[model samples]
Target: MLKLDHITVVPPTLAEGVRHVQDCLDIEVPFGTRHEYMGTHNHRLQLGDGIYLEIVAFDPDGISPRHARWFGLDDQKTVRSNWDAGRRLRGWVASTNDLRSVLAKHGEIFGTEVPLPPENPVFAFAIPKDGSLPLDGAAPSLIDRRGVPVSSEKIPDRGAVFRSMTLEHPEPEAIERLYEELEIDHPPRVVTGTEVRYRAEIETPSGLKELT
Candidate 1:
C-alpha cells in the first residue's frame, strides 16, 4: 500500500517556516539537515504516525542546484511573495514501495524520472524539466524508500496526527487518472478547482489544525 510519507511546508527561510508551524500547532519543531543537492534545509516534526511534517526552504549557503530544485523552491518570485505575506503549507509527498512500476504506470504525472541526490536517502521522483507537476503542483510527488524505515519515532513529538489530505486541481479527472494508474492505496482526496491547491488536516497538541 502507498503511504503518506511527509507534507512539505515551503517557507522563505527555515526559521520562518518553523515559527509558522509552532505558532499554529503550538509545538516546537526541531531542525533537520540540509539537502545540499537541492539547496534546501528543513525543520521537521514527527506526526506520531508514520508520517512527518517538513518545513523546507532554500539554504542560502548551499550551492545552487545544477537542475531545478524540488518543492517548487526554484520559483523565487512565488516563494518570496508567499513569504512576504505569511509562511504557509506548500505541498505533500506520498511513498510507494514499487516505485519503478508506479513510475512506469504514471511517469507522465511526475514529468521524468530524475535521479535523487546522493545525500537524499529515500528515492523520490522529480519535477520535469519545466519544474511542473500534472496539475501545476497540486499533485503529490511520488517517493519510494526501498524498505528504509522512517525515523519518525526519533523525531520530537508535538502530538500531531495526520487525519486527511486533499488535493484540488483544475482537471480533477486528470489527477484521478494519475492516481488510478499509480494505484496508490491511500491517496489524498481529489477535488475540482480553478487552480492547484493542497490541504492537510492534522490533530495537533492544541486542536485540529490545517496546513495549506
Candidate 2:
C-alpha cells in the first residue's frame, strides 16, 4: 500500500533553506547527507507519526544529472517563506516496498517514475514532464529521490508530532478512487482547492500549534 511519506521543501540554496526554516518555526533542523548525483543536500525536521520534513536545495558544486536540473534553483532566487504564502505543498510521495510495480500500474494515470541514483532507490508518481508543479509563481515538474527518503531513526521528533494529513482536490471522487486503487489510507476529510494544503498539529514549547 502507498503511504504518506514526507513533504519536501525546495529552496534556492541549502544554507538559506535551513536558515529560513529555523527563522520561521523557531526550531533547529539537523543536517543530512548530500546527494552526489542530484547536486542536492538537505536538512531534516521530525514530525509526529513516521512523517518528517525535508528542506532540500541544489548544490552547484555537486554533480547533478541533466534531467533533474529544471527545479527551482535554476531561477537563482531564494524562498523567503516556508509555505510560499500558501502556494507550497505542490506534491507529496507515497512509500512502497515495490515501487517498480506500483509505477507500472499507475503509469497511465500518474506519469512515469523519475529515475534516481542507485544509492537512492525510491521512486515517485508525478505529473508528466510537460506538466509541472508551480513554484515561485511558475509551474515546474516534480521529481522523487527514492533511496534517500528520510529514515525514521534520523528524525529527532523533539516534542512535536504529525497527527494526520489531508489532501484537498476538486475531483475528490477521482482522488479518492486513485487512493483506493493504490491502497493508501484515505484522509478523514477532503476539502476543495486548486492546490494542496498540508495541515498539522505540532507540540511546541509554548503549547500546541496548528501548522498550516
Candidate 3:
C-alpha cells in the first residue's frame, strides 16, 4: 500500500532544523513550504530518485492548529532531547495510493487520515491524535497524495542521492513484520537496537555521508 516517500528531521524551530541538515549534508536545503493548517513549515532537499529530505518545525509566527502539530513538533522537550542525542535524521514517511483502506486495517499503528490545508485540500496525512511520530519513529509516517507521484522536480537537487536506510528498533522482528504487512516499497532495513531510530546513507557531492 505504500512506497518510500521522504525522510525527515524534526527540530524545535526551522532555523535549528536547517542548521542540523546543512551541517550533516554539507549543503543548504531551500525552503519547501508552510503548513498553515498544521501551524508548521519546512525546508526540503532532493535526495535524487524522487526522494527528498525534509526539515520541519513549529512555526512560532503561525496560528496554532486545533489539534497537535505533526512530527511531534508540539513536544519540543522530546524533540530537543532527541536532537541533543544526535538523532537528527529522525524518521521517514511513506506514500500510498489507498490510504483509507490502509488506515482502516492499521489505524492503531499508522493513525487516522487527516486531509490537510483545511481549505482546498490537496493531500492527506496520517497523524495520531497526539500528533506523535508513528510508533515513536519505529514505523514510517504515512501520506496519501491522492495519486500524485512521490518524486518531484520542485525540491532542490544538490547531487545528493539516497543509498540505503536502516531502522533501529528494540523489537526489530515486530517492526519487520509490520513493514511486510504494509508491503512498503523501498522500506528501510530493520536492525536490533536499544531504541527506535533511523539512519540513512546518501551519496552527496562531497562523497558518501551518513545522516542520522
Candidate 4:
C-alpha cells in the first residue's frame, strides 16, 4: 500500500521558498541537505505523523544533471514564472514498500523509476524521460525509501500539524482513479481549471492556516 510521505513546495529559489514559509506561517524551517544527484536543495519542516514538508528548488551552486532534473526545475523560465505568480504549493510524494509493483502497474503514466545511490537511499519515479510532469505537476511523485530515518526522528517539529491537504486539477476523474489505485485517503478534488493547484491546511501556533 502507498501512503502520503511528504509534500513538495517548489519555489523559484531555495531562499525565497524558505522565506515564504516563514512569512506565511512564521515558522522556522530547518535546512535539509543538498540533493547532489538532482541538483536541488531543500528546507524541511515536520508536520506530525511520519509526514513532513520539503521546500525544494534548483541548487544554484550544484552542477547540472546529465538527465532532465526532477520536478521540472530544468526550465528556469518556468520556475520564475511560477514564483512571479505567487508562492504556491506545487506537488507531493507518496511512499510505498513495493516500489517495483507500483511502477509495473503505472510506470508509464506515473513516470520512470530512477534509483538513487544506496547512500542516499531513495527510489524516485520522477517525470518521464521526456521530462513532462504528469498532469502539469499535480500527480504525486512515487518514492521508495530504503533504511532512512523517519520524519519524526529526523525533522524537528515547531508545533505544526497537518489538518488536511486538498489538490485541484482540471480533470479530476483520471487523478481520482490514480489515487484510488494508490489508496490515497480524502482524494483531491476536480475543478474546472487550467492548472493543478494545492492547498494544505496546517495547524500552527497561530491557529490554522493554508499552505498554498
Candidate 5:
C-alpha cells in the first residue's frame, strides 16, 4: 500500500541539515517549502524516479502549533541526541493511497493522520501523538498526497539518483515483519544493529556516494 516518497535528513538547524547533505553527496540542496502549520521548513533535491531528499528542521520564525511537530522536531533534546550520534540520514516517508485504511489497521505504529495547512489542506500526514518517528525511524513515516504527486521539477536535481537504503535496528526481525505487513514497495533493507539508523546509497555527479 505504500511506496518510497523521499528520504529525510534531520539536523539541529536547517543550515546544518543542508550542510550534512552537501558533505555527503557533495551538492548543495535547494530551498524547499516551509510548513506554516507544522512550523518547520526544508531544503530539497530530486533523486529521480519520483523520489527526493529533504533536510528538514524546525522553523524558529514559524508560529508553533498547538500539537506536536512532525518528524519529532518538537523534541529538540532527542533530535540533537540522534544528530550527535551520527544518525543523520534518519528516516524516510512513504506514500499511500488508502491512508485511512492503513491507520485503521496500524494506527499505533503509524499514528493518526492530520490534514496539513489546516484551512486549505492538500495532504494528510500520519504523525504520532508525540510526533515521534514511525518505529523510531525503523519504519517509514506515512504520507497521503491526496492523489497528487510531488513534482520532481519543483525540487532541484543535481544529477542524483536514489540507489537504495538500508536500516539498522536492534530488532531487525520485528521491523522486517512490519514491512511485510505494510506491503511497501521499495522499502529500505533492514538489518540488526545496536540502534535505529539509516544509510542511503545514491548515484550522484561525483559517482556513487553514501548518505548516512
Candidate 6:
C-alpha cells in the first residue's frame, strides 16, 4: 500500500537549508552525500515514526540536473524567490511499490515520473514540463528514493514518535478518491483549505505535544 512518506525543504543551498531546519526544529541535522544524477545534495532530520524531513538544494558545481529535481526554479523570478523565500513548507511525497501502475491510473493528477539514475535507485513526481499540478508556485517536488528512504535510518527521533498525521484539503471526496487511487493507507479528512496542513502528535519527555 502507498503511504505518506516524507516532506522536502528546498533551499538555495544545502548548508543554508540544513541551518534553516536546525533553527526551526531546534535539533542537529547532518549533511548527506550528493545524488550525482540529480545534481543535488541534502541533509536529513528525523521526525519519528519512520518519517523524516529533507533539506535539499542543487549542487551549483554539478554538470546536469537530476531527473527528479522538484521545485521549478529554473527561471529568474523563481530563482530570485529562492524556492518560496525558504519559509514555505513546500510539498509532500507519497510512496508505493507499484508506481508505474499508480501513475497510469492517476496520470492527470501529476506530471511524468522523472527517471532516476540506476545507481540512485529511486523515482519521483514533479510538475510536468508543461507546468500542471496547480502547485501555487511554491510547492516542493515529490521524490521516492528506492530501497528504504534515507530519513528512515539517518535521522534520530530523540524520544519522540509520530502518533498520527492529519491532512487538510478542500474537495474532501476528491482528495479521498485520489488517496484511494494511490492505495495510500491513511484516509485524509476533508477540510476547507486548498493547501495541505500536517498535524502530528509527538511523544516527548514532557508529554505529548501536537506539532503543526
lDDT of each: 0.74, 0.55, 0.86, 0.76, 0.92, 0.55
- Across 116-168, the per-residue lDDT of candidate 2 in tens digits comes to 55455554434444333432212112344455665678776666565655555
* Decoy 6 TM-score against native: 0.70
Candidate 4 accuracy as lDDT: 0.76
C-alpha RMSD of each candidate structure in angstroms? 2.6, 4.9, 1.2, 2.2, 0.8, 4.2
Encode model 1's per-residue lDDT on 125-194: one tens digit a residue. Answer: 6566656434455667767667776776666677789888887678889778777656666777889976
Candidate maximizing TM-score: 5
Residue pairs whose backbone atoms clash in candidate 2:
48-161, 48-162, 120-147, 121-147, 122-146, 122-147
Q: Candidate 5 lDDT, tens digit per residue, 1-212?
A: 78999999999899889888899899999999898898999999999999999999989899899788989999999999999899998899999999999999999988998998799989999999999998888878999999999887799988999999999999989888889999998788888899998999999988999999
TM-scores of all candidate predictions against the true structure = 0.85, 0.70, 0.96, 0.89, 0.98, 0.70
Backbone collision tally, model 2: 6
Predicted candidate 6 versus true structure: per-residue lDDT over 103-187, tens digit per residue:
5765555566776664554565544565322244222234455555654565655554546545556555666665665566663
Cα error, candidate 3, residue 13 (Å):
1.7
State the lDDT of candidate 4 residue by residue for 82-114, as single tens digits. 777763578777777777787787777667767
Best by lDDT: 5
lDDT against true structure, model 6? 0.55
- Cα displacement (angstroms), candidate 5, residue 115, comes to 0.5
TM-score-best of 1 and 2: 1
Once fitted onto the true fold, the runs of candidate 2 whose alpha carbons sit more than 4 angstroms away are 69-85, 113-116, 119-150, 186-188
Taking all chains together, the TM-score of candidate 4 against the true structure is 0.89
Give candidate 1 regions above 4 Å deviation: 82-87, 119-124
True-vs-predicted CA distance for residue 129, candidate 1, Å: 2.1
Error of 4 at 55 (Å): 0.4
